[model samples]
Target: MRIDTRVEINAPASLVREKLLAFSEHADWNPFFTSIELVGCDIRDSDSQVKPGDRLKVSMKDVRSGKVSTFTPTVLSCTAKKFEWRGSLIGQWFFSGIHTFEFLEKDDSQKCVLLHHETFSGIAIPLLRPLLKGTQTNFEAMNNALIEVCENGC
Candidate 1:
């Protein structure tokens, strides 16, 4: 199963990408992902940049229930145009999700489109399907918040 959401922001792709990767600043704008901390890295070091193999402790809030769940996901890729991570519950065979953020620049324009998605797999998907119903809306809320931050000079 997958949950994908997209939003167009009136900001340069570079700016959007920068803000997206700025994990330290996520709490200021991201509603779904309330907090993201680089694991094994000092939180005080605001300059820390995430790279492949890095692990992150993320706190996510359910938009509908206001419930928060924390998980540690390993960074799969971090690049100028994309960021991806993989998180598993118990084991990969049990449940896992590959989350990605992709930035696409509009043709010859300063605006950009952001694609936020997560691909879920494993045996638990069928049982967990109902819980995922509100995920799309949560992602949309985060995307809109990103637009606010990027366009308002964050």
Candidate 2:
């Protein structure tokens, strides 16, 4: 399943990119991602910003699990307005997936688009199809929150 939605922000592209690229500020903007606790990050050695091939140990928790889920994701892309990460589900037999966020320059500001794509093979297809609806809802909410933050100067 793939879901994509865009929101126009009043802020300039640089500010929007900064908020999206900074994992440390996720708690204030992202609705689904409660927090990104860095258990380990490859950037510990130098001043270089995170890039493709960089790995991060992220701890995330939500209402569904009510418990933190830990996993390691390899950064796939970290350009000026694009960020993507790929990871597998830990402590489970679920399929591996990719999550991406793209911020495109609009007229005077930016258009932030969130993409959630999940690929499942075998018997899981039937079970996962129905779940995509809820997943889409959450993604929309997250986009709205991001827009609000950008518009309100958060």
In candidate 2, residue 83 scores what lDDT? 73
Give a tens-digit lDDT track for model 1, residues 1-154. Answer: 9999888899998889888777778888899999988889545444236788889999999878999999999999988788899999999899999999998999665999899999999999999999889989899989989999999964
Name the best candidate (by TM-score): 1
- Model 2: ten consecutive residues of lowest lDDT: 112-121
lDDT of each: 0.88, 0.62
TM per candidate comes to: 0.92, 0.72
Q: TM-score for model 1? A: 0.92
Looking at model 1, residue 62 earns an lDDT score of 87
Off by over 4 Å in 1: 41-48
